[model samples]
Target: MSLSLFIKYIHLFALGLLGCYLLRYYGDLNPVLASVLCGLLFSFLPFQSFIKSTKGQGAIYAGTFAAMSSSRVLNSINDFVLVCILGGLILTLFEGRFEGLGGRKGMIAFLAVAAFYMYRSVL
Candidate 1:
C-alpha cells in the first residue's frame, strides 16, 4: 500500500480505538454524553439540512461540531451554546461567499473552535 494510504488507515484505526476507550471510561461523563447527543441531533435535525444542502456550509458545520465534541469545556450547556454561537459567527464572517464547497465551512468552524479553546487556555 502507498504510504499515504497506510497512514490514513493507521489514523482511522487509532481513532476507532480511542473512541472505544472514551466510551468505556468516560461514557458516564455528562459532557461526553452531551456532545454525542448533540452530534446525533445535528445530523438528524431538519434545520441543519441547510448545511447539507450547501456543500461549504456542511463542511464548516461538521468541522465545528467535531471540534466542539473534542473540546474540554463542553461540559456545560452554557459553554456548548457559547462555542456553537462563536463557531457559527466565525464561519459567517470569514468564509465569504463560498457556500458550496464541501467541508470548507466545517474546516473553518473547526479552526475557529480550536482557536477559541487555545485562547481560553492561555487566559
Candidate 2:
C-alpha cells in the first residue's frame, strides 16, 4: 500500500481506539453518549492533512485518550497528579519528540493544565 493510504488507515484506527476508550471510561455520560460525543469530536478535527502527514497524529490521539482514560482508574489525588504529569510527558515525548509539536508549547501546556484541573475536580 502507498504510505499516504497507510497513514489514513492509522488515523482511522487511532480514532476508533480513542472512541472505544471514551465509551468505556468516560464518567459524565453513558457508553452510547460517550461514543457519540467522541465521534463528534473526532469528526470535527481536520483530517485532510492528518491523513496525509506522517507526523504522529495517530499516536497523539491515542496517547491523549489513554491519558484521559486513566482518570477513571486512578483512585487518589496523588495518583491522579502523578499520572497526569508522567503520562503527559511520556505521550508528548513519544508522539511529539521528532517534530517537537511544531513549537506549540503554549497549547501543550494549556492542555496539560486543563486536563489536570478537570481530572482533579472529578476526583
Poorest stretch of ten by lDDT in candidate 1? 8-17
| Candidate 2 runs further than 4 Å off | 49-123
Candidate 1: residue 1 lDDT (0-100): 26
lDDT of 2 by residue, 1-123 (tens): 244544444445345445545565655565445645665566567776653354444434433444344444544546444434543454445453546445343244335545655766898
RMSD of each: 13.1, 11.9
Error of 2 at 94 (Å): 30
lDDT of 1 by residue, 1-123 (tens): 244433332332223223323453456555435445544444565543443344333433343344434545444545544555455455445434655555554465466557667767888
User: TM-score of model 1 relative to the true fold?
Assistant: 0.44
lDDT of 2 at 116: 57
